[model samples]
Target: MSTPLRLSTVILPVRRWHEGGRRSWERAEDLGFHAAYSYDHLSWRSFRDTTWFGAIPTLTAAATVTERLRLGTLVTSPNFRHPVTLAKELITLDDISGGRLTLGIGAGGSGFDATALGREAWTPRERADRFAEFVPLLDRLLTEDAVTHRGTHYSADEARNIPGCVQRPRLPFAVAATGPRGMRLAAEYGQAWVTTGDPRLSEAGTPRQSRDAIRDQIERLGKACADLGRDPDTLDKVLLTGFTPDKNDPLRSVDAFVDFAGRHAELGITEIVVHEPVPGTVFAADESVYERIATEALPRLG
Candidate 1:
């Protein structure tokens, strides 16, 4: 048995924060996306111009413009910031978002980022082990009145976090795990499993890549939860689909739109976040992603 999954997609809020992360966010809100998200990268290779200034700042700016949408970092790495500091920032953003914040996290393992952070890029298993410990600890700190935690990687001395999560106990947490260990973490600790669609081996394109692999990942995620003595069906699942349509050009037909969403739906992906990249900013491709999204993708997904 697996948890009931609904629509959730991580869209590129902006190509780069400094350039137009704010402007892209306005489109996401207008499109009625359930949850909007941005990638966290200190250094980007393919698109050097696009860099992560700070996901929280961009999300905070989004909070001011929209009220109904939920915002999160597609996957913020754990190595860059201290645990307490990260917790505090998320808490503040939680308040700013009016309780519509989902915290998606992962390990920093890219060559450039790992070296820059001074944290060794551990293997998948090691990263999973750390996340398994960290996610729950963070969850407790944000949800409980006070937290006394001690683990292999972190220790807290009678931590008392103020203004606990504004959301219910289920302060949405997305673990963007693509491996087995990550799958287990998502099941045991994550409120939802966040996935970037199927990526091609060729690294020359935008992250607007996806495939039916989501079904397999979702199944793996379910089994992981079951192993932890938890009901897989009790968890929440969100899958992100990168939708790039031609704006002024449009998708040609409504049936085409249905076909696109239906493919994801058939694959057990209920919710999708349409990522629109900022032109001449973070995205090296084209600016049409935004217009195509508003006219074709969002309307159909909505």
Candidate 2:
């Protein structure tokens, strides 16, 4: 039997009242959201000048505020963090959240995060190599008592973890991967795999185009899992839906939202993460859109 469809919302921690962000997480939990996530960027695109909070601390606060809502980053990269330090932080967070933390990791992307740290920009291949090493090392750091690894991008010297994660073996890893190399990492190490679809096919196209890209990616992931002799059913599939209500939004109507979710659910998406509206927008000020989703969209998804 397949897992039921789950819903998640991305809450970008950029509100004037940081406490308001906590309230947003609480609201999501109350609204029956499966997970509440924020982006793991030092500064996000276009909102680079805005008041942004670190993903770890924001998630920590969300954990403290909400009893049951799972908290995580939409996708965390190793652009600025070392495995040794990251393992400790994640383990502590998992403990605090009572083992309801999901680590969504991706290959480091080039842009503000790279330059902000005064690090040289690396090629795509180099980034993948780094991630290939990073995930396994971090996995060991979390599951093992002591780990010593020396790699090209990072090194851990007799790193010791005291009181490892509350989740036995380690917390769940929800790895984001849209490429073959990254998919292999996801199959090897991830408890779940997430995809936002191919930008080339969907960025300038219609909602149908976006769904098509996601379908292709999902098929590719299934093949990747099979190639590794891994059961695809073991990995939960998450689709990051890029729909934020605005004028001419494709998923504007309640019916549209339900249909859109159903299409993805049919494609084997266990979880769909819709991007939260920007603060001060009509959609953000009033959460009728989300409320309708809870009522009309969620039940039909299963």
Candidate 3:
């Protein structure tokens, strides 16, 4: 049987505090969201000069405040992480969250974060190769103890993972991949494959065009899984929608949200994540929209 569609939302930690963050996550839990996530970037594009918290610390805080909502990074990357250290940090987080942790990883994108920390900018191909190495090494370090390895992009010498993760054999990975190499890696190792859908879907395209683009991506993922002799059904297909709080947002209306989810289900997507507006402020002054989703749109989608 197909798995039921799961819903998650991303709460960007720009210009926010602990109490505010706690309130936001708690509200999501109360709203019956399956999971909540934060972005892992040093400085995001739009809010480069604003206050921002580290993804891990924010997530740890979120996990502590919420009892049932799963916590995750929208997509953490190798931009500034050493796989070995990152592995240890994630394992500790998994323990703290009592196993309600999902690791969302992606290839480092080019932007402010690419050159912010005195690091040289990497080309697209280089970033892809680094990501390819990072995921497998991280997987090994999380699952096996005393991992020692060397790769083109990273290295670990007798790295020991003691008092391992709460989730056996490592926590679930939600890998973001929109390319062939990334899709294959997701098929081989991720519990979920995540995409923002094709950019064209959001740019100069209608709803039907958006759905068609997603279907094409889904078919590509299926073929990648087949090539690796893995069942595509085993991976949760996650689509990220609703970037803004306007008509552009898929969750802007209850009917539109339901239709969007139904189309994703028809395309074999098992999960959908939306971007939540800044909580506890004028930007997100109306919490009714969220409540409506919990009481109306969500039930219909299910």
Candidate 4:
């Protein structure tokens, strides 16, 4: 049988926990979202000067207020994070959330995060190379009681994560990728594969073109899994909306979302993650319509 469609959301960490941040998390759980993620960045585009908080701490706090809501980073990267330190924190988060943490990882882009650490930004090839080393080392760090490894980019010196993750081998990894090497890593290490349509087509492409792009991506991901002697069916396909040409159309109304989601679902997307409406930002939308899509549209899909 095909995997059932699941609805999730991304809540930007643009508010203080006291000033409505905590409530957004609670509301997501109350709305019955399967998972709620926040961007893992020192700061993001446009909102760079706003009240951005640390993704780890924001998630840690969310874990306390939520019971069933799975918490995660939309996509964490090696831009400013070290595997050893990240593994230790993830273990704690898993225990706190009762095994509800999904680690969304990626080869980070050349955004503000690239230069925030006082170093030159890595080239595309360099980013891919570093990611190749980062994921495996992180895998070992999370599963093993202690690890010592020296790689081209990162190293762990007998780093220990005793009483490891509550999720047995480790928490699930939702790897975000659109390239070959990255897809291979996803097939090798990810529980799910994530995409945001195609960046190249985001500007001029129509919704149909975006759908076709994602369809092609999913096919490539399957081939990558096959080459690695893994079952592609075992990996969930996640679509993080808003980057597509259709942008916020899916959140405009319950019917619009159901229609938008249905088309993607037909293309083997198992999970659809939308952004929670933010009033004054690019992600802004009608709050009631967003809620209706969650409370009403999802059930219709089922």
Candidate 5:
């Protein structure tokens, strides 16, 4: 099978700058990115160096401004909103994008994401277990008729989606996962699996480890599928990572990108959602990042 082309996006993570939101998204599409993504964070844990983009509104702005680029959340917490309401919002965005929408979800295992929203941080295992039940509930609501039942921590009665999603019934739903349960949930119920690297973050000489991690995740996902009697080869697995564009030389920079691309691709990464930070915020957040991405990077890589 052919590997899908890789591309990136600038994050507008829970801060407010509508102009920046519009510009970055427009620029991403004009510069040939595949999508624009945002994160869900009600408030920053530390105010030391902070930025927050009210995710939904910022993404609505992105959807309005850009014509072709798909928009998505890195991941949204399932506990924070009723599945019915969240499904409505997603379907609304689907209409806005004319079907170019990707939905990513998980229990969101971090305190930074959870505690800030007045929710408790789930133990990794609990998040995994919760995911096992969570994925089925969403699947039934989005695809079947009259989903009604209860699970360990959630319940719904005939909560079928209204207006129905305009995207194909099997829309590109994804799950954010880094370990076993998340991986398997993605395999069974997702159009794609999306996750950033480990919480420790990336460093020099560690691409190989990241590669190993993904391979293991994919293998686990495959096993999870097999146990369920589901075919494993058909799933689209993706990684959410930052793409670093270097200015000094195209060869080295593009090589770095390909290595970045290949490391994940080798382990069944069907797509890459580049989390290239916006200028003036964090790493690679400068004109140089955009310049290298535009002038030096795309030409060599694509």
Candidate 6:
């Protein structure tokens, strides 16, 4: 049987909790989204000048107001975070959320976050190297009582997580990657694999090309799993919309999304996460159309 398609949303941390953030999350749950994620960045592009909030605190606050909606970072990174500290926060967040937290992690990018900590940004190779160490160390930190590790990029000494994650063997990791090394990590450690299609083609590529790119990515993920003697089908494939060539087409109307989703679903995507319309920003869309996609289009997928 094919995996059932799940719909989710990413609510950027641009709104203050009292103002509208809380309502957005509550509405997402009411709308029946499988999960609601926020960007785990210190400050994202364009929105950097606005009221950007921290991902951890935002999700933690959302947890209090939500009951069943799974909360998580769209893709947290080691950019300015250490495994030791992040794991502690994640454990608390998971417990508070009643084991309804997923950690969407990646190798991170060299944008604002890379230099926000007052340090030189890492090269692509360096970022990949750090990511390799970050995931395993984080895994151990969330699962073990005390961890001691020494690595080239990060280190922890007898770090203690008194009570481990609420989720057994630690909360699920939805690793974001489109490269070989990263795919290997996802196969080895991730419960889900995330992709945003191809960045190179985000601006100039056609929808067909974007789908082809994702198809290739899924194929690579399968091979990585095969090399590790693991089943590729075991990992959930997630596509975070907007970065693909399809862009806002999926949000233009219910039928557009249904069509866009059906095409990607054929490529093995189990979950599709669309951004909640933030007018005037790159994520701008028709809110009513977006809601229709949630309330109307999703059921049609089944």
Order by lDDT, highest first: 6, 4, 3, 2, 5, 1
- Candidate 3 per-residue lDDT, tens place, 162-267, comes to 8788999899999999899999999999999988777654556676776777788888999999999999999999877753122235556677778778877888
> lDDT of all the models against the reference?
0.64, 0.82, 0.82, 0.94, 0.65, 0.95
- Superposition TM-score, candidate 1 onto the true structure: 0.79
Query: What TM-score, to 2 decimals, does candidate 4 have?
Result: 0.99
Give RMSD (Å) of candidate 3 vs. truth: 2.3
Residue-wise lDDT of candidate 5 within 172-199, one digit each (tens)? 7778776766766777788777766554
Steric overlap count per candidate: 9, 0, 0, 0, 5, 0
Residue-wise C-alpha lDDT for candidate 4, range 195-254, written one tens digit per residue: 999998888999999999999999999999999999999999999999999988888888
TM-score of candidate 6 on Cα atoms, chains taken together: 0.99
List TM-score per model, in order: 0.79, 0.93, 0.93, 0.99, 0.83, 0.99
Displacement of the residue 125 alpha carbon in candidate 5, Å = 3.3
Worst 10 residues of 3 by lDDT: 242-251
Better of 1 and 5 by lDDT: 5
Residues 1-302, model 1: lDDT tens digits: 42232333345533465466566677667765566776666655555454446667878888897788788887787656556667878888888889999878876564566667565677766666777777777877787767787799877777777877788774677777778777777787777776655444224433223443566777777778878988765666555543232221123344554566656556566555544544454233334544454456544554
Instruction: List runs of model 6 lying over 4 Å from the truth.
Output: none
Q: What is the Å distance of residue 129 in model 2 from its true position?
A: 0.9
Backbone clashes in model 3, listed as residue pairs: none
